[model samples]
Target chain A: MSEAIAPALLAPGRTAGMNWRRLVPLLLVAPLVLFMLALYALPVLAMLSRSLLEPAPTLAHYAELAGDEVFHRIFTNTLWTTLVVTAGTLVLGYPVAMGLARARTLLPLLLIIVLLPFWTSVLVRSYAWMVLLGRHGLVNEALLAMGMLDRPLRILNTPLAVHIAMVHILLPYMILPIANALRQIDPSLARAAAGLGAGPWAVFRQVTLPLSMPGVMAGILLVFVLSLGFYITPALVGGPRDMTLSMLIAQRVEQLDWAYAATLSAVLLATALVIIAIFQRAFGVGTAFRMSAR
Target chain B: MTLAGRGASVALNSLEKRYEGFGAVRGVSIDIRSGEFLTLLGPSGSGKTTTLMMIAGFETPSAGDIAIDGRSVVALPAHRRNIGMVFQNYALFPHLTVAENIGFPLKQRGVAKAERARLVEEALELVRLPGYGTRQPRQLSGGQQQRVALARAIVFKPRLLLMDEPLGALDKQLRESLQLEMRRLHADLGITFIYVTHDQEEALTMSDRIAVMHEGRVAQIGPPEELYDRPENRFVAAFIGESNFLPATVRGREEGHVVAECAGSLVRATCTTNPAPGESVTLAARPERLRFVDGGWPAPPPANRLAVTVTEAVFVGERCRYVLRTGDGTSLVLKEPSSAATRRRVAGETAEVAWSVADTILV
Candidate 1:
């Protein structure tokens, strides 16, 4: 009797002739697929097509962008600031992530501090940094009071202000992945390295850092890509000379130069894709996004 | 790999480790000779692993000093102490290949690449993993990974090797095989090995000396046979192996042996601890040292004997084990060869158990 029931159980289609189990998941995801296609993919593709078909199907806009010296300066500025912000986040976030991974009693407190910025709006965070780095602000006032500075430093409305505010906004993005990676590493590896006569620095270089590379890579890619597209933080904190590509694209749209804006957006999208493709080829995406070192 | 005269002697002078006013290891002083294979054998939280960590310099002692070759190394960090440690999890670097993992210490010490390769290859061969240099740690089985961990620890030829339950992760069969392999490696390298394990059989099978720890103290430390045959206290006797502890009253002392009255019978056991007459004592006897007397065979005239009722008789391959209850309801276990003479005694039958004076000790 059990043997007779076994084949019927195995052949579910024999009874219903339909596999709703498989179809249910596809049906469940169909709405998301349609939503993304309608809301995200179509508009982006339509905007990209304008770069080719706009101004009577001429590539003149892209040529103009390439030859324009102001565009070149803003593009270089964007790249430099993005690189600086990415590097700054890495250097500032690594030790905090390491501390979070190893902390026993202070873990929750440190985690809360790392995550506090995420609770606030990005605009608010940028404005807060503007206040802190502004002339006659708290830092300048303190420095002046301490007699350490002869005059108020021009910290706000410069490339330095943009870099600092962007780093502050994107630091949690850098820290969380690295902390997750560091947490996944077995602590025995460090002890084992030490036991084999590697000092603290050697242990970190040999074991801890190498194992945490995936998270580090993830943080770098996320921070760099996000910083490349930063608009309000740079616009609010940056001086006129520190104009970024995103700010320029926004300005072109406001001026009703839709063709130029589309061309610039296409360039930004292409650059992001090329950067991702280079990194993906250099280190497999699987390694970069791996959840655990093991 | 040959070592230089088995490394240095380690002396832990009254080592104490207290965590927030609670003692983890209290007053542990052990003098390990050069090249000695000393195993700190104890149950979990018994301070054996803590003691090993202190010697490895991973944990600082709250008080007391540790010395290598009579020179204090308490202030030295782990890397400067020249000690090799094999963690229970193996702790192999997942990112490095087996060869790179084995050669990591050599690289850290600034050895040339060519020489590092030679030494790594030799270490791999020593651990019986030659030609497996390119394999990742995840590609290997548990036993293979264990061997890689051992190779990595010993490749640097450190003065001492500390293994914290290296075989704890393997199955019983694999653990047994690895125990023999580790013993062989210790012999070949002639380096001091301080091994930690909670398994009694593993300790007995591997170590030249076993320190049985209990409640943050060493209950007994001696050669395996000596520890097994003559444990110092009740904890040691019970922890090292199975034992029957019976409450007894000391009747008298004669020739350094105590005559104790227990379970309506008189037992004469050797007593290192002198108990006055009429004082309460405990007599410990191993099951193998006791046998049942039946009708077919005559009972041996031993110094200690008890009249017990056989409550259960179990056939355990080569032998039969009988759980017996004495007249005063004191339970005892007796083991005898599974011969025709012993097979007749079943549950609910009366039997006379006997043991020699030397086999039973007063604790």
Candidate 2:
């Protein structure tokens, strides 16, 4: 009796020959898919099409972007800043991630601190950094008061200020993924390694570090991708010359040069996509989603 | 594969692990002889795993010292102690291939790469897996993963190998097979194996000496046969196998055994310590040891007899288990082989159950 009922119970739609049941899961997301197509996909496609179609269908804007020395310098500076910020967040984030994974009692408190940055607006945080990094601001004032600096230093409008603020803002993106990865590791693996004659450093290097690589990769990808599109943080805290691709695109849009802005935006989007594709191919992008979703 | 004379004698002296207001392992001290397979067996919260962890150096004892080969190792870290350990879950590194996982310890010890490969291959062969070097951990089944974990632990050639319920996650058939394989491996390597498991049968099947634990302490430790035949206390008797306990008062001594009174009859039982006359004691006897005595056969002279009413009789394939009640209402189970020679008794039938004095123990 159980066997006879099991088939229908297991796949009632199949017994009824209702093929539409298979699409039910996909149908659940139909509304969100349509929403994305209208709000995000259509806008991106239209903007990308404008880069080629506007002012006569030509690749001249792309050619100019590739050949322009100023564009070259700005792109290089943006890459450098993104790399710096990625490394900065990683260096500052790993220990905290480890702490988050290990500290049972302090986990809730540590998690709050890590996620505290997300509660505030990015624009507000950038302005706050400007206040802190500005000449005679809190940092300089503290430095002067401690007699560490002879005078107020030119911290604002420099690459360092942008890096500091960006790292501070993007740290959670790096930390959460790493913490999730670390937490996923079975605690017995370390004990097993140690029992097999691995010392403390050896256990960390051989087991802990290797096991946490997924989170490390996830964090690096998230932080690197987010750092590329940063406009407000770089614009407010960066020096006049430390212009990123986003700020340059904003500058073109400000001058009503929509075609050039579209071209730059398209190129930046393509670069980010290429990086994400490479990351997805090398290390599963699902890990990033899983870790950061927590 | 030719691991012989490589075992280290381990002595845990008054080992204790306490947390907050309670003790996890309180005063567990077992002297494991070289090359002996000693299993700490008990149910959960019996401190068996905790005791194994302390011996492995993953857990620090609240007091007392651990010595390997007469050298105190309380100050040494887990790695420096050079003990191979296998966790219950087969804790193989997920990122590493089978060969890399096996060679991890050798790599840490700075063994040359070529030597590492050679050792890894030999270890794989030792665990009966060959040419499985590149297979990922997730690709393997639970039994295969456990084999890889065993290979990885033994590849380092640590003098002591600690296994924490390595077959706990396996099915019954697989667990039984692995238990035999572990026994074979222990005999082959002669490595001092400190195993921990909650399964009494697994411990009985594999160990040279079994330490039955209860309530964070060792209830009894002896050879399997000795522990089964002569359990020192009530916990050991109850935990090792099925036992029927009857409340009795010590009456007198007879033929080097203690005679006790239970349910208006005299029961002679072997005791580790002499109990004074009129002292209340419990007599433990195995179900299979009790037999029905009838008028056709002469009742054995040295056998202790009890008059009982057969309340329930169950015909289990090989044996008939009869639940009998004595005059005083104390219940007992008597197992009789289902042979054509012996007549089966039904409910409400009056009978005399007799068992040899040696089969009963005073606890």
How close is each model in CA RMSD to the real structure?
2.8, 3.1
Tell me, by DockQ, which candidate is best: 2
Worst 10 residues of 2 chain A by lDDT: A13-22
Lowest lDDT 10-residue stretch of candidate 1 chain B: B292-301
Q: What DockQ class does candidate 2 belong to?
A: high
Tell me how far the alpha carbon of residue B107 in candidate 1 is from the true structure, in angstroms, after superposition.
1.6
- Stretch of 10 with least lDDT, candidate 2 chain B: B294-303
Deviation (Å) of B118 in candidate 1: 1.5
In model 1 chain A, the worst 10-residue window by lDDT is A13-22
Candidate 2 scores an fnat of 0.94
Candidate 1 clashing pairs, residues 3+ apart or interchain: none
Supply the TM-score for candidate 1.
0.95
The digit string of per-residue lDDT tens for model 1 on B1-363 reads: 677476678998889999998999999989999999999999999999999999998999999999998999889998888888899999999999999999988988899999999999999999899999999999999999999999988898987899999999899999999999998899899999999999999999999999898878888999999888998898989988899989999999888789999998988998787789999988999998887544333545676889999899899878888899998898999777777644557799887888889988887
Best by TM-score: 2
**Positional deviation of B81 in candidate 1, in angstroms?**
0.5
